[model samples]
Target: MEYQWNFAPIFAHSDALLVGALGTLRIFVVCLLLGLSLGLLVGLARYSTRRLLTWPAAAFVEFFRNTPVLVQIIWFFFALPILVPFEISPMTAAVLGISLNSAAFSAEIFRGGIQSIEPGQWEAGRAIGMSYAQIMRRIILPQAIRRMLPALTNRGIEIFKMSTLASVVAYVELLHQGRLIASLNFNPIETYTVIAVAFFLFLYPLVRATYVLERRLGRSD
Candidate 1:
């Protein structure tokens, strides 16, 4: 039998698709910001001379990094509600789970960037009588950010892709919306193909920009 490709049904529900994409972008941005802040603190802890600080951060990174994100999302969405007085939304679960995971990786990126700085730079800051905090704030982080940007941008794109995982928790990102529309219209191929193309179009620029910046920075390694 010859098959007809029908996209009309999906486009008829364009509003839903748009909403899903927005939700995806929302979670992606929120996760990136949360990961940045949390990862910085965690990275700082990992770099600390004190074992007290390093151990917990190391544990945090290991737990999140080693665990599958799907399990994390499910646990947050389902298990946490049983333990807490309030209900947890799937969107919140997705954000928290994936952001925590991203934070673990980002922490490592931050640690690497921080460590890559020359020892002389640290000593130069000390020679100026800068406090540890001042050195970090004024010297270390500024330099580290240049190194971190390409990796972080790549991470941002990865987080954007991972937004599809939110669908498993029933948070309606692009994939979830596409799935529902496909089931409704009996055109899984058309629906998912569009979603895949949309993701590619949305993400390609970011990946390209990161490549360009990495080349410019002479830190492509």
Candidate 2:
């Protein structure tokens, strides 16, 4: 197949791409913070002694983890208003949906981190007269987080890439903007090449950071 290459249109709309990039960043940062916070709480809850606490947390993790994120996004964007009584913009809906979905997976990651700690560490903490909460905070969590840092970094990269799904909900993220530009100029190949490059530009640093953290953690161990 012979294809004519035109880089001019992509460059001409660089400003729009920049705006879309900012939006993608905004969604990612907000989602990461909120998701991590919620995930930590859910992870802790999953380990709780109370059935009331643990069951709900387990249910949430199962439901979200088992379902596709795209379905969840569609539900939030379309059915949420009917189920509830509040209005939400598509962008807000998209961000909230992805954040909550990511939280479920992150909770599992946190649980694994907590469980990976040697039982001897817990025994030592208790031997030192520390309460469960104190031991978790002062002894176990620190080491577990250090061990989990690479996994967490990888999750961040995954969430960043997943932000492309925001286009489905009419959130003007990078891929959506690229599509719009292509639609106007009739240049899918050129437009998508630029979009792919932009995605790489954003994600490459995160991949590098993950590798670096993995190495550092390996050395510390």
Candidate 3:
């Protein structure tokens, strides 16, 4: 048996597909931004001298890193209302699920980056009579962040690709729309081929940038 390939159905829903792709990009960017901020704090806490700070940060990383993001999405979407005062929507659940999971991994990246900085740099800040926050803000973070730029950018790309999982929550992102279109048109081959091309066009550039960045970073290393 041979399969027919027709893009008429896809073309018919081009507007919806475009909207879905844009939605996917929007949520991916939002979650990555949120994850960046949260991960920075968690990373710092991992380097903290206080047991209280380190313990909680460690637990957070372990829980998110070990658990399946799909489970987290379902839990937040379905079970959160019982434990929290506010009800969570599918979009919110999807964002939180991927964002927090990215944060855990990003935290480790940042922790490694910060640790890569020389200890004397911290001492220099102290010698100048700087507070812990001041030292991190003025001296440590700027340098540490520079060292971690390549890793952080790569993480952003990873998070962007992971946004496909949002489909499970009915968020109407790119992959979700493709799945829906395939089901409706019964043209799985054509539908998924377009999806693959779309993802390739979107992701290949970022992957290239990552390679370029890693090369530049390696030169500095």
Query: For model 2, what is the alpha-carbon lDDT of residue 154?
Result: 75
Give the clashing pairs for model 3: none
TM-score head-to-head 1 vs 3, winner: 1
> Residue 13 of model 2: what lDDT?
91
Error of 3 at 150 (Å): 2.7
How high is the lDDT of residue 126 in model 3? 99
Give a tens-digit lDDT track for model 3, residues 1-221. 87767899998989878988998889888999998889999999998989999999999999999999889988888889789999787789999999999999999988998899899998999998999899899988877887788789878887887888888878888899999899988888888899878988888897787778667656755
Tens-place lDDT digits, model 2, residues 1-221: 97778899889999999989998998999889988889888998887789999999999999888887778788888989898998867788878778888899889888889999999999999998999999999988888888888778877987898898888988988988999999999999999999898889888987897788778767856
Shift in Å, residue 32, candidate 3: 0.2
Cα RMSD for candidates in order:
2.3, 1.7, 2.2
Best by lDDT: 1
Candidate 1 stretches greater than 4 Å from native = 1-3, 211-221
What lDDT tens digits, residue by residue, belong to model 1 across residues 1-221? 98888888888999999998898888888988998899999999998999999999999999999999989999999999999999899989999898999999999999999999999999999999999999999999988988888888877887888888889989978999999998998899999999999899889987888788777876554
lDDT of 2: 0.87
Clash count of each predicted structure: 0, 0, 0
Question: Which residue pairs of candidate 1 clash?
Answer: none
